[model samples]
Target: MAMIVFYEKPGCMNNTRQKQLLAQSGHDVVALDIRAQGWSPETLRPFFHGVPVAEWFNRAAPRIKSGAVVPEAMAAAEALAEMCLDPLLIRRPLMESGGRRMAGFDEEAVNAWIGLTPVSEPISETCPRSDGMCSVPGRGN
Candidate 1:
């Protein structure tokens, strides 16, 4: 019922699934390539409203997984600056609708914000692969 602005990394499995769920719920999904977008701290900061700085990151990112970038250790300004430098550091499926913005797809949270169709199986936030890395083309630091 809502027009969702879904920012995602193109070809990411989780993002694809998230979009499908929104569509099935009858929401209009406008999928944009997060990596390709020109983002600034001001524009990108809203998605993580009320969330801790550490949780603003895409945990599946190579830098994070490798421990090269410690989200928990960084300050809010530092985290936002790094994320703006590399969009891959930002969480997936950053969504906006009806002037409200959110990061990540917690089923209950999304459903509460804008109703999601009932699903028997749970929609997970992470990549399903054992390697823990998403198969995103051209993905790098």
Candidate 2:
């Protein structure tokens, strides 16, 4: 079993589900609140290595959803700066294990990196609260 440092937004449903999956798969999950982290460009950049700058953002973040922060329009340095100032802009469940890191949860990628139990239900990376029915009060997806 691997020890994964999982950075997440507290009380997020998708993050909760993702953590449950990792635990059930026999991996040790160390959950941390993403918003509480002291983020800097150097520290945050590694998690998004090789990923397009636009993909570094949390599409469900209020700023992104409101069209205020357009990931596609921002450069790498700019994106990182914005994310540092507002960690909610960073993607959910940034995970690190075995010296490798990943930003978002892709079932196939995760299963290939660290084995996962065969699941019948589909897992979604997007926040469920976006539709206004998730557990976190007053937070939109």
Candidate 3:
């Protein structure tokens, strides 16, 4: 079993589900509060490797949802700066195992990296809510 360092926003449903999946798959999950962990560009940048700058953001974040922060319009450095200042802007469940790290829970990618139990229902990436709002109380970062 792998030891996974999972950085997430507290009280986030998606993050809770993701951790459950990892644990059920026999991995040891160490959950951290993403908002409380002070992050810098160098440390946070690796989670988003190969992804476009726009995709690095948490679309559910209030700033993004409210049109206060435009992910698509920012450059890589600028985006990183913004996210470092407000971690809620960073995508959910930034995961690390062994020496590798990744952002977001892409089921296929995660399965390949650390093996997830096969499921008919999709369990990663997509928000479970349909109203464009999360079920958890208090707006997601």
Flag clash pairs in model 2: 129-141, 130-141
* Candidate achieving the largest lDDT: 1
Which window of ten consecutive residues has the lowest lDDT sum in model 3?
126-135
Task: Give the Å shift of residue 19 in candidate 1.
Answer: 0.7
In model 2, what is the error at residue 102, expressed in angstroms? 0.4
Q: TM-score for each prediction?
A: 0.92, 0.92, 0.89
Report how far off residue 31 is in candidate 2 (Å): 0.3
RMSD to the true structure for each prediction, in A, is: 2.6, 2.5, 2.5
| True-structure RMSD for candidate 2 | 2.5
lDDT of 3 by residue, 57-118 (tens): 98877788889999999999999999999998888889999999999998999999999987
Q: Write the per-residue lDDT of candidate 2 for residues 41-130, one digit (tens) a residue.
A: 999999998999999988888899889999999999999999999998999889999989999999899999998987899689988766
Give me the overall lDDT of model 2: 0.88
Worst 10 residues of 2 by lDDT: 132-141
- TM-score for candidate 3, please give it: 0.89
User: Which residue pairs show collisions in model 3?
Assistant: none
Instruction: Evaluate model 2: give its TM-score.
Output: 0.92
lDDT of 1 at 15: 86
